[model samples]
Target: MKSRYIIASITGVSLSLMGIVGAQAYSGENLAKHAKITMTEAQGIALKARPGTITDEELEKEKGGSGLRYSFDIKGTDKVVYEVGVDAQTGSVLENDKESSHPD
Candidate 1:
């Protein structure tokens, strides 16, 4: 019985580690694989919605596929940063919020 329990624990741990490793490999800079819109198009869409220059971006999808969006961090001409999420499927802005970027 003790051996059985140890085997089960080892199996569970291995599976969990595999899952994490797989996910890390899966998300490595291949945001365009599942996006219907091009990264430039998405950047344009986000700029039109919020009006800023994109400084950074990443495509994100929830583990279960309930959410998929492109996250763009933009810096306005006046030096304010904005975080925008544009839907990967529909090419629409899902959400936008300003972030504090203190300039010294």
Candidate 2:
């Protein structure tokens, strides 16, 4: 009985960790339900506005179009980091600008 309980506990922990890892695909996924444009569509819009390799992306609420936007941090081929914001509801490019370097 003790061994069975231990095995069950380990299995539960493993499953929980797996869930967390899987959820890392996107931040603010909870807000996805309110978004008219899917994440894939937003990505395309952002890339078209400013071509680059996306380093980070998230859906967030802010004072903007529909109050919700998909923000992407893209590293350009020139090595500059650019922040692109796309409206979650309309798929419009809200912001496309170079990212300022912050002091550590």
Candidate 3:
């Protein structure tokens, strides 16, 4: 009876962990699809347009929205950092602004 209980407990724990992992994977895939454009493609476009490379990229959840927002950073040749936003659904460039730059 004790052995059976232990086996059952272990199985329950394993199943719970599997469920958590599966949920995370599903969320990641959904974010990717909603973004419309892949990370690689965004990086390529940023590199071509901006002087510096892409430092970071992420999908942000808005307060009252169904789709996610894609945000990225690009450091220019003058060492200026710019924040760029792209529409997740249409892959349209929303905003591009220089946040900061190296002092003259």
1-104 in candidate 2: lDDT tens per residue? Answer: 99999999999999999998987678898899999999999999999999989988999999988999999998887888899999999999999988876221
Q: How many backbone clashes does candidate 2 have?
A: 0
lDDT score, candidate 2, position 50: 90
TM-score winner between candidates 2 and 3: 2
Which has the higher TM-score value, candidate number 1 or candidate number 2? Answer: 2
Task: Name the regions of candidate 2 deviating beyond 4 angstroms.
Answer: 1-6, 101-104
Question: Each candidate's lDDT (Cα)?
Answer: 0.76, 0.91, 0.66
Give the winner by lDDT: 2
TM-score of each: 0.61, 0.84, 0.55
Q: Assess candidate 2 and give its lDDT.
A: 0.91
Judged by lDDT relative to the true structure, which candidate is superior, 1 or 3?
Answer: 1
The window of 10 residues in a row where model 2 has the poorest summed lDDT is: 95-104
Instruction: Please give, for residues 1-104, the per-residue lDDT of candidate 3 as tens digits.
Output: 99999999999999999987876533244577556677666556556556586676776765323356566788778777887765566566666788555242
lDDT of 1 by residue, 6-67 (tens): 99999999999998777643232466677787677878999987887787788888532227
Task: Report each candidate's C-alpha RMSD, comma-separated, in the order given.
Answer: 8.9, 2.3, 6.1
Better of 1 and 2 by lDDT: 2
Show pairs that collide, candidate 2.
none
